[model samples]
Target: MTTYFVGFFLGLHRICDQVMAIKRGNYRKKKVSSTSWKKQLKSWSIRIVVGFFALSIFWVLCLKFINPPITYLMIKRGFQWQSEGKGFKIEKDWLPYDDLSNNLKRAALAGEDAHFMSHNGFDTDAIKQALEKNQSGKPLRGGSTISQQVAKNVFLWPGRSWLRKGLETYFTFLIEIIWSKKRILEVYLNVIEMGQGVYGAEAASHYYFNKSAKSLTKKEAALIIAILPNPRQWDARRPSNYVNSRANNIVRYLSHYEIPD
Candidate 1:
């Protein structure tokens, strides 16, 4: 999997460089012989296409097998959250899809990925935006949707390096291909890191709402989703003004967003 992404990224880098050169009108001036250049371009094109296909296939396979316990292992090995100074703890108690208010799903999806149902695994536009913004300063935008989060929590490690990213890409493809939207959302609810040493919807609800996962109110659910971006610092129980503002925005938009029957 590493090998595949390495090749794919390299191929993409070349494509980007070539496109930049073309934009600068230097592509026609390069002396590397037309025949060789054409052949190389064709080869890279094929490779990029094939690599993406293989990546999608691998992601589907992993969804069928790989799970979130890998996150537990990473935590057990003393992987602390660097930014927030916290650890994650998971507790499982599956909430029936009905018990939770419909707005909860809308809030999470809107907060994370508005187009979650449409994208396969990755949101290229979101990634592109993140890249551009991160280049100017520290990265603030994360393009990961519920599906990718589900994959990361269940199958991938948290190294925050190239290797972890590569594995994450592979596993993101896995969950998108193998699991239903419901399954992906379910696992996300059960495994997402909510606070310092706090994980799973049940744990979060018990701690924040003084209730079970099944009893979380729409406002409470919105609060939970609001703190997800940086659960270590943000507290759903006592949200800052920003989190509170975002939660209300989610509620305002909820009626338009529909949940599947």
Candidate 2:
């Protein structure tokens, strides 16, 4: 009877060992599967990032020679106008680079980015000043260069998020490298929103001054540019005291500006 009991105990021990072995095998398989999934996800993420980089570069290169028929901001503004119960209007007329008035260019440079001719795609000093001022709890202001504005208006949506700003920086760098200074200014003048649903120099010139873009006088150009920060709020046709002061400042310093050849 004792020998029989011992044999039975040995059989139980063998069964337990087999079950343990199976559990170990399953755990190993699970570990391998998890690792494989992670690797696949990482590989796909890398491919997507590389693909976006390549595509963005190609788009920028094409715009170097080709004028964009419309921009993201234009479409966004169109929708906004429609939603506001105002009839959707997109007034933009593309003009040749040479047809753009020198006075308008000078006013833009003087009022918007004084160092436009010298900076790469950003103005470090202005950014530093803005940061310092914001830290002091002043009104929120931006140090976006004209190049950055072109990037945001042409390729991106309106926002103050970090992602949008990061993309703006990327596009700005790309345009500075791919397009000439003249081309950058041309695209900026052609795409920038001058009023609610009003885009480009030609449209703003006709709407505000009843003149063509090439015929904008010095004071007329300065007035138009003065309302640029908040064109929807300020009217160039009837400038307020503040707008008039800003326009005067821009005109006073207009001679100091040098347009890119």
**Which candidate ranks first by lDDT, i.e. highest?**
2
Residue pairs of candidate 1 with colliding backbone atoms? 59-173, 59-174, 67-154, 68-154, 87-197
Model 1 lDDT tens row, 74-179 = 3653354533454543344546555655656776776777777788878889988878878866734577777777766676655567677777787776666677
List of clashing residue pairs for candidate 2: none
RMSD of each: 18.1, 1.6
Off by over 4 Å in 1: 1-70, 73-92, 96-99, 137-141
Q: Across residues 71-110, which tens digit of lDDT does each residue of candidate 2 receive?
A: 8778878888999899778999998789999999999999
TM-scores, each model vs. reference: 0.66, 0.94
How many steric overlaps are in each model, in order?
A: 5, 0
- Looking at model 2, report the run of 10 residues with the lowest lDDT sum: 136-145
TM-score of 2: 0.94
- The alpha-carbon lDDT assigned to residue 15 of candidate 1 equals 100
